[model samples]
Target: MERRTDRVMPPRYLASVNKVIVGLHRLGVPLPMQALTVPGRKSGVLRSTPVTPYEVDGRRYVVAGYAKSDWAKNARAAGRGELTRGRHRERVRLVALPVEERGRILREFPARVPRGVTMFLKAGTVANASPEAFAAAADRCAVFRIEPLD
Candidate 1:
């Protein structure tokens, strides 16, 4: 398979799919997906994107398959966002995980969110979808710990 750079914009079809997923999530569908809404770093307008949360022990995390994606940059600047799934919504603080601390969490990503592995592979974030591959790509991928706010 050919490798694609992360700097490449996501395919146009993904925008349509994201709209559908976000729409479904807003309608209270009980899917394993959530809509993450955060302010754009420069635009300041709120942006929503579908994300799969990965849990390890008691902690929840969201990973950016493309490290430099807009959402990742926005989340880093905004520091907080809203996580919504079905009818449930909660404010969350997204703390970026250091590269050194990302390996263990990424090692479980393939098993915990197998469906998401394809994005990483297609984006050239990892060589393969194996746990080891994800782990090895820690520095290239962005990870955020999800902390709930009262």
Candidate 2:
């Protein structure tokens, strides 16, 4: 059994894992994965992606580890999206943080999600582990604060 991880794993491998996770999520199985669906900016069709939404200070957030990736762009365009976990689906509106605030959040990632740091480090999204390094790298990534759309 192989684990699907951002570091060193092929894109196809992670895509496969994401597919399986999305299926299970639809089936009402509880998992750490969040199956996010948003309308594509260009096509206007719904686009789906898997992400680990984390919490900080009681607010949920999603980091664009790859920086302006499709999901992030779609999310920006759509403004609102669905976040599914098991049988639960919540409508969320993404609020992009300012560059200064985003820089602060980026510095927190290394301490809070070290594995993510390693992954992003390898992907060149995160240049270094130092606070200054992450701060500098922050403007390159999109950090969104997710709020449940009631």
Candidate 3:
């Protein structure tokens, strides 16, 4: 597979697909998605996007396949956000994991949330969908631990 060396941006076509997903989510379809809402770094207004979270051990995490995408930047700057899945909502602290700590969590992505691998693969975020590939891509992406503030 060809690897994209440049920064990844969501494909323009995803805008339409995301709307359908968002509509399904609003209708209470149980997809493995969360609407992550964080304050914009410059604008302060809430910015929301759909993310699929995966788990390692008992902890849940979200990954930024695009590395420096706006949502990732906002989550890093704001340090917290709201995760909404259907009618379930939770306030959470977004703890950016150190590079060294991200490999294990990332290695689980392909197995835990297999469907999400396509995004990373298409973005060239990983060399391949293998666990080892994802582990190696840790430094190229951002991993955040989602700590619920119930």
Q: State which candidate has the highest lDDT.
A: 1
| TM-score for each of the candidates | 0.90, 0.80, 0.89
lDDT of 1: 0.87
Question: Any runs in candidate 2 off by more than 4 Å, and if so which?
Answer: 1-12, 129-132
lDDT per residue (tens digit) for residues 12-74 in model 1: 578799899999988899678899999999999999999998899999999987778899999
Per-residue C-alpha lDDT of model 2 across residues 1-150, encoded as one tens digit per residue = 212233322244666777888888878898866889999999999877877777777888888775657888888878889998888889999987878888777777777666566656565555567666666776677788999997
Pick by TM-score: 1 or 2, better one: 1
**Model 2 residue 5 CA deviation in Å:** 20
Among all windows of ten consecutive residues in candidate 2, which has the lowest summed lDDT? 1-10
Better of 1 and 2 by lDDT: 1
lDDT of candidate 1 at residue 113, scale 0 to 100: 96
lDDT of 3 by residue, 7-62 (tens): 66666777687777777777777667778889999999987788988778999999
